[model samples]
Target: MRGQSYVILAIIFVIIVAIFAVINVDPVEVNYLFGTGEAPLILVILFSVLMGGIITAAVGLVKMIHLQREQKSLQAENKQLKETAGENQLIDDDNNQENPDGKKNL
Candidate 1:
């Protein structure tokens, strides 16, 4: 199912690109800091879109890594807390079994 969804999405993307390319067939001159070149308007648009996607993905990847680290730390802290609570509970039970004379009863 995931593969099928990817295929459908790819088809839709290709159709949209094709429509954009057909509509923007004129060649445009692009001037950069070092040089200048002529490229089709569609290519420019596609390049811009690809660069934006790359940047967004990079930012999202960084955020995901940070969140994963946070999650791992939180999980470790939670386990530690549980263990401490269990130990405290056992000590509480033991103390409750004793009387106020500071000696074990029964």
Candidate 2:
């Protein structure tokens, strides 16, 4: 359900950008750091949107990689702790059998 809502919102946003870009079809002067050039307003708007999406995807990919690495490390730590706990339980059972009286040694 949450994913469906996101898809709907994305479609709406794309429609809005498309309408806005279509409405501004005039050529405009765009100033670049190296130089200046003339291009259609629609092209500029679309290009900006594309670049923004690329940058956002790149950032999201990096974050996902970090999370995966953290999850892997946590899983390994959890497995080690379980093994240690199992060993401690075995030792505890041995000590209980050694005590003839139903009382702990310590």
Candidate 3:
């Protein structure tokens, strides 16, 4: 499972990089404040990609949290079932007559 995930992740990364490269848009430069210059095209594209990744991660995180809550609820229910079964077993045991001296009452 882990290997497959790694392979898939690599493929996705390759696809993204290839897409960016294929577009081949020229990098734009911008000046701000006091004589500071920046490349507009690359910066904007990179920031957009980063934001998209962050949004995707947040969605995944929410899903994981929901699944964890469900798992906890199931575990609690299972424990309750086990306890009830044990209690029933004890009641059944008490109904069976047994002599205190390691023998049956019959």
The top-ranked prediction according to TM-score is 2
Highest lDDT among the candidates is held by which one?
2
**TM-score of each prediction:** 0.75, 0.91, 0.61
TM-score for candidate 1 = 0.75
Off by over 4 Å in 1: 1-14, 98-106
Candidate 3: segments with Cα more than 4 A from true spot? 1-8, 11-39, 96-106
Question: Candidate 2's residue-wise lDDT over 26-65, tens digit each?
Answer: 9999999999999999999999999999999999999999
- RMSD, one per candidate, in order: 4.1, 1.6, 6.2
Sort every candidate by lDDT, greatest first. Answer: 2, 1, 3
Over 20-102, each residue of candidate 1 has an lDDT whose tens digit, in order, gives: 87799799999999999999999998888789869999999999999999999999999999999999998888767967787
- In order, candidate lDDTs are 0.90, 0.96, 0.80
Which TM-score value belongs to model 3? Answer: 0.61
lDDT of 2: 0.96
Separately for all candidates shown, the number of backbone clashes (residues 3 or more apart, or on different chains) is 0, 0, 1
lDDT of 3 at 81: 100
